[model samples]
Target: MHINALKSLVMDAVDELKGQDVVTLDVSRLTSVTDLMLVVSGTSSRHVAALADNVVEKAKQQGIKPLGVEGRTGSEWVLVDLGDLVVHLMQVETRQTYDLERLWSDFPSDIHEVRHGEQA
Candidate 1:
């Protein structure tokens, strides 16, 4: 699929697992590593793992392959790397500690917040 469509598909996959506090950041200008960074919170490690797994599965079902997946061992923070999109699934505590949103917050215009099945 096209990049935008792929991005929406990935976001949709994240939503499927009911991930909380979902946010999509357009980091394409800051880094070529990925075009979009999707951050989400899960209630627990198990939920984090499930969310990551489900996203990978769902993406693959649509013929989209991720470059890599990391942090499955701890599940405290799981990352799914698609070429143009990187997904971060974290527990609330871990997410707070890392403060990715804050670290990347400089690019406010790049952010698109989605939570509770609605956009902010």
Candidate 2:
């Protein structure tokens, strides 16, 4: 799937499940690992897991298979890797603890805070 379309699909899925504090980082110029990174927060462990599942399901519906999924066992944070996009679904506390936004934003890049699937 195209990057933008995949981004929309992922964002929509997160919005559908009410993922909190959605943030999209354009890392294409910063890294070759993936073009974009989406960091989302969930209310709890279950919410985090569900968000990851939803992203995977939505991608599959569009014929996009994820490269990998991690952190489902604990559910505090779940990551869905979709080649061009990598999604981080984490519990609020975990998100604060790791502070991915600050970590990645340290470098020069476009950081967009997304709310309800729209840039905030």
Candidate 3:
């Protein structure tokens, strides 16, 4: 699927589960591993795991198999890799600790907060 479509699929999945503090970072130039990074915060570990599962389920329904899934055992921070886009599902504290947004702050990229399922 196209990057934009994939991105929307992720956003919708996250929104379906009411993920908080949704953020999207364009990292195509910063890294070749993935074009976009979506950071979503969940209330707890279970919430994080559910968010990741929803993303994976939605992707599969669309015939886009995920390359890999990580952090399922811990459920603190689960990452769903969909080739062009990587979805990061984390608890509030975990997200604050790693701070992916600030980690990539120095780079010239399009970073925006998503509110109410609307792209900023």
TM-score of 3: 0.90
lDDT of 1: 0.85
Model 2, 38: alpha-carbon shift in Å?
0.6
Pairs of residues at least 3 apart in sequence or in different chains that clash in candidate 3: none
Instruction: Compute each candidate's TM-score over C-alphas.
Output: 0.87, 0.90, 0.90
Write one digit per residue (lDDT tens) for candidate 3, span 67-119.
Answer: 99999998999999999999999999999999898888766765444444564
Let me know the TM-score candidate 1 reaches against the reference structure.
0.87
What's the residue-level lDDT of 45 in candidate 2? 91
Residue 70 local lDDT, model 2: 97
Off by over 4 Å in 1: 107-120
Error in Å for residue 101 of model 2 = 0.8
Across residues 1-120, which tens digit of lDDT does each residue of candidate 1 receive?
777888778778878888888877767777778877889999999999999999999889998888899999999999999888889999999999998877876664555444435644
